[model samples]
Target: MNGQPGTTRAAVVTGADSGIGRATAVRLAQEGLDVGITWHQDREGAEATAAEVRDAGRRAAVQRMDLTVLPEAADAVDRLAEELGRVDVLVNNAGVGTAVPFLELELDDVREVIDVDLVGPLVCGQRAAQRMIRQGDGGRIVNVTSVHEHQPRVGAAPYCAAKGGLGLLTQVMALELAEYGITVNAVAPGEIATPMTGQEDVDVLTVRRPGVPLGRPGDAREVAAVIAFLSGPGASYVTGASWSVDGGMLRMGPHAGSHLESDSWRRP
Candidate 1:
């Protein structure tokens, strides 16, 4: 687990322009890790995140990466490693959320979700694994999954499939990469107050859904803390595990009721 002299660890966080990815990048930088950030269509937001990381006294690099083109994925990782010297941790946090029902969902939409959420991670993981093996140093790969990886969502057919596939992919990676001393795991979070969910309109507690026992939506920082652990030394023994950060939302069954009954409560 030795890092380069000036840089202890270099981390690459995809979809880091906002939400969980942004929070995780900042947190990792605070922990003394130089970070490489990627954005799909938010260069401004990505640069803003890079500024925050630099303000924390960690080096930051921002790049634009569209993960759908699978071949380009390895090159992105290679570029990050070259720029930052070495990458000791890779956080696959880039993903898209879709709310269309299965029947209404088109093949293209489903493919897009899978390409970003599942296939993109696979491509990144492969590239990182090769580097870790070459470095002959133990490395970490943490995938930012969702509670839907285990529980099905009513309107998000494609998202659920992608996460579920990613959950299994994590385990497969852990098994295969153990020989190379690489640990792979996942962090499945529930309703986090982030731009991904239109945070300004969400009132987790007052809405009072039956399933979420905590009666509140989680903050991105909360999930980032767990991710930081998995990436650090403490979680060396933890691999192939999907840690659920949801507030008991997945635990409640049939009894959970919809909190979005009133049209007036919706965001304008």
Candidate 2:
């Protein structure tokens, strides 16, 4: 609440080129927050998201950042805050996933996923918290996680491991940052329809999976709405929690040694 009194609230969202990140950026802008959008490789898409933010009558700043580099992640947050004036919210939504068997997975690939999903968020969150504390205002940090954070996936060993670690990390951050008035939380989305997974081929409603009770893939906006709640004033008391948006996917029993059909759902 110690942020600029008359200036609009600002947020920095990484991986905002497309999918959940893009949708969250637009949604935050619509909610009257200026947004700083970052893209890993999709400059055009990031610009498009910025355009939408501008059209919403909010300020937008777009940047290119590779999350694998910790310095770059911290630098991006600093740059966003410098350009946007202030960052009241930071969304760690950038991540990578691969569908390789655990035994067959390369060490390099596993390390890459962990670096992006874990270390990257840590760097960005630390930078954001530093600014928030210095400004004497409270801030929010929302980590975009996956259902795999609690539930394991057969072909997605690295993703599950990274997300599980991220879940714990969120809790630790929430506890440590509490004194600074910064809240840390996570949104673990199940299956959201986004470009990261070939959107055309995914039928969330039609996919007959025994796990997901909703029997449908979630929409990016749905996840974005939850993130908005946490980023906004309503969730001031909510911290150190990873809200699962997986439509009950993690509640299913684990049937090991059972041969299951390839469920080609991808995380965005």
Candidate 3:
């Protein structure tokens, strides 16, 4: 879906302060779209991303967003869209996870994960889609899920639950928004070299994961490339699909089940 004939496109990418969020913001800027960047705790990082966007000859707007705050926080999406004139694409990339075992998890922790990972995106998607509908131009929405969205991971009960829910939510949004020419999809990533994974600034190629078909963790840029494609004109026909950037990790389910040599994985 193209924007007004001669106007530049604009996008709002949540969690754009670092990792995949930062990468996606910059990549979209390179695609000739002005970007609205959001940061939860890293204002400096968000500014850096904005600077990169500016360097790419596109406008950038930065906002601090706390997704756990609910419907109020979703307002940031509209603010960014306003600052950038209009929002042609929205990438819901902000998320939180927990490593606590199921029995040890507290209600607050679970709620926090659910708020940031699931509910928050839903509201933000609504905001962006509403604007797109009013503009009368088709739009794009990309939800960043995880491989856990399809499978399970020990010590990540709430995380998996939230992601799985988000996966299905993506499908529903696609179905409903398609009538307005707004396409919704999800991008599921595997282990990536990012701050969330405790691998910030590390070279992914230097590390090896024998179990992964790619033999290494993914890079944030790698994930951003996929997201950029989905946000571009080329992916106008693709929606309600979950594109896995997991180095074939999901395909190893049966292979890994048969190759386990110990009970270590059973512990979280």
Candidate 4:
């Protein structure tokens, strides 16, 4: 909103200590926006991300946030907005995964996943949208979901449910926020070579993922590029959409099912 004519813009990227969140924060900074980075338990990684944004010659702010606490989560948005002086773009990238089976999962497990993944984003988005509405200018909100948003995975009942909920939430937000010139969309990524994928220090290309058409895990920067596009002026007409950055994994459902000869897929 601020970058249209002569004003500067700022973005808040939650869960930006590392992985896709860190990459997106840096990408937005490179695109001529100040960045606000947030972390839950990785303050060092958040500071490093802030350094990367500052290295790009953009203003950067870092804060620790526990998204499970909805009020504090919303407060995190306000804190970053105040620090950056504006909140033109918001990337709700803070999320957690639970790989427990549905029948075996404890109530706490499912609730924690939902609280952080669904409710936290809902609150944070509301807070950011309110600020954007007050600014009277257009803004962008990109929710980083997962491939599971569109499909189910084994041993990840809570993660899948939370992502599915978020997918629909993105659409509803897009519909409601359109009046305020705020575009809401999602980026659903597949197996990426991040800490979440158990290969934080390894090359994504080296990771073997035959199910993906790309035949390997994706890099965090690849997903960040897609997120950056949605947040930019070029995607003005795009909203209520989930951009899948999964190396065609979703498209390989039939092939994957047929190729699986073991009962391993059924066990989870």
Candidate 5:
């Protein structure tokens, strides 16, 4: 994502049909930018998000995006850029995970996870950056990685690998795209109270996660607020960094050794 100093800010957020993507699209709209939203299996949810953005008095364009078809996924951003007349932000929030154990996980499942979580974002980010580079002003790209991006979790081998790879990819993109004035970053959310976690229509502020330091599940808006910061003027100097919005869940690792009172944490 690259934009000039005076360019109108527009954003394309994948997986916007629900969850963090939806919150991000809405939040960016509230911040005064038009939004383009995409989804693979939920056009209704995407439209709902569009309505929310419109309610915020911003234009919204909805489309289908499936990272399994890499080119089509990338092209979704182009379509949005055309509709919004500019592309200043690209939030790569679409991702999938498999819970099957490493030994039991199918090759196809691993392939799908890698394609959706890692390669998909890489390609989509490149497309957005290319447009931003052409636009002559730098822009922003925020990849919605996961806590797994920094550490592994049981039964999530493929997801951990893909997010871990995406973390490094964010750095590489930041280094290369900096010349064009584009900033690339990642937002690693621990456990957001959204449909992905079987917690739809949730009040994020009240969600609890006893396992984390904050003792709460993060709201999608909390994560989006961080993404908004990265996309807005305040984060102009920030790039190639991964912001953790997981209620400090990532910091619990060291304490687990001596604090284990039960095996509940190991339960999936």
Candidate 6:
């Protein structure tokens, strides 16, 4: 919002220590916005992301955020906003998932996933939107969802539920925030080469994924590019929409269902 006529702007990207979060922070920096980087357990990775933002000739601030900590943990957004002077964009990129079967899932684990993936973003978005409203300038909020937001996986019941809820939450936020000149959207990513997928530093092109239309795993930067666009002026008219950055994975649902020769896809 501060990037109006003559003011400077800043963006806060949660879980920016690595993967898509890190890439988004750097990309937003390249687009002429100072970046606030957050990490949970990877302080070094957060610092590295901040350095990348700085190298892009933009200011960078680092903060440690534990989404599991609830309302208190979301305070990192305010702290980063204060450090950066103004927050014009917020990327809710931090998330967690589980592989436990639904029937075997412990209540505690399910709660943890929901807390990190859904509640955390809800609170963070509130904090950021409040600041943007007070600033009286338009702002952007991009939620980093997953392809599971639209489809479900066998062993990720909580993850799917949280993401599905978030996809709708994005629409509600967009509608409610529109009056305040705030745009809300979600970016759903598929199999990407990231630490979350245990594929950090691996070349996506070399990893074959026949089910995906792209025939390979996606790169974190590829998702970041779409996020950056949604966070910028070019996407001013876009709101409440969920963009899929899955290399066409979501489109293969029926195709995959019919091609599967065994029950392997049924298991986690």
- Judging by lDDT against the true structure, name the best candidate: 3
Residue pairs in steric clash, candidate 4?
none
Which residue pairs in candidate 5 have backbone atoms (N, alpha carbon, C) closer than 3 angstroms, thus clashing?
1-139, 2-137, 2-138, 2-139, 3-137, 3-138, 3-139, 4-137
- The 10 consecutive residues of candidate 3 with the worst lDDT sum are 257-266
Cα lDDT tens digits, model 4, 33-138, are: 9999999999999999999999999999988889777677679889999988889999999899976777899998888899889888999999999999988898
Superior by TM-score: candidate 1 or candidate 6: 6
- Residue lDDT tens for model 2, 99-143: 998889999999999999988998898899999988788899999
In candidate 1, what are the lDDT values of residues 1-268, reduced to their tens digit? 6554454788999999998899999999999899999999989999999999999999999888898888686578889888987888999999997988778989988899999999999999988888888877879999999998998888998999999999999999999998887999999999888898778335555545444667678888889999999999889889899999987767756545234333332224
- Of the pair 5 and 6, which is ahead by lDDT? 6
Which 10-residue window in model 5 sums to the lowest lDDT?
254-263
lDDT per residue (tens digit) for residues 113-167 in model 3: 9999999999999999999999999999999999999999889999999999999
The numbered model that scores best in TM-score is 3
Taken over the whole model, the C-alpha lDDT of each candidate is: 0.86, 0.86, 0.93, 0.89, 0.89, 0.92
Write down the TM-score of every candidate.
0.91, 0.91, 0.95, 0.94, 0.93, 0.95
Instruction: Mark the regions of model 6 whose C-alpha exceeds 4 Å error after superposition.
Output: 1-4, 257-268
Query: Would you give me the overall lDDT of model 2?
Result: 0.86
What is the alpha-carbon lDDT of model 6 when measured against the actual structure? 0.92
Please, what are the lDDT tens digits per residue for candidate 6 over residues 1-268?
4456777789999999999999999999999999999999999999999999999999999999999998999899999999999899999999999988889999999999999999999999999999999898889999999999999888999999999999999999999999998999999999889999999999987876766666788999999999999999889999999999988878877666222444454345
lDDT value, residue 212 of candidate 6: 68
* Residue ranges of candidate 2 with Cα displaced over 4 Å: 200-211, 255-268
**Could you tell me how far off, in angstroms, the CA of residue 12 lies in candidate 3 after the best superposition?**
0.4
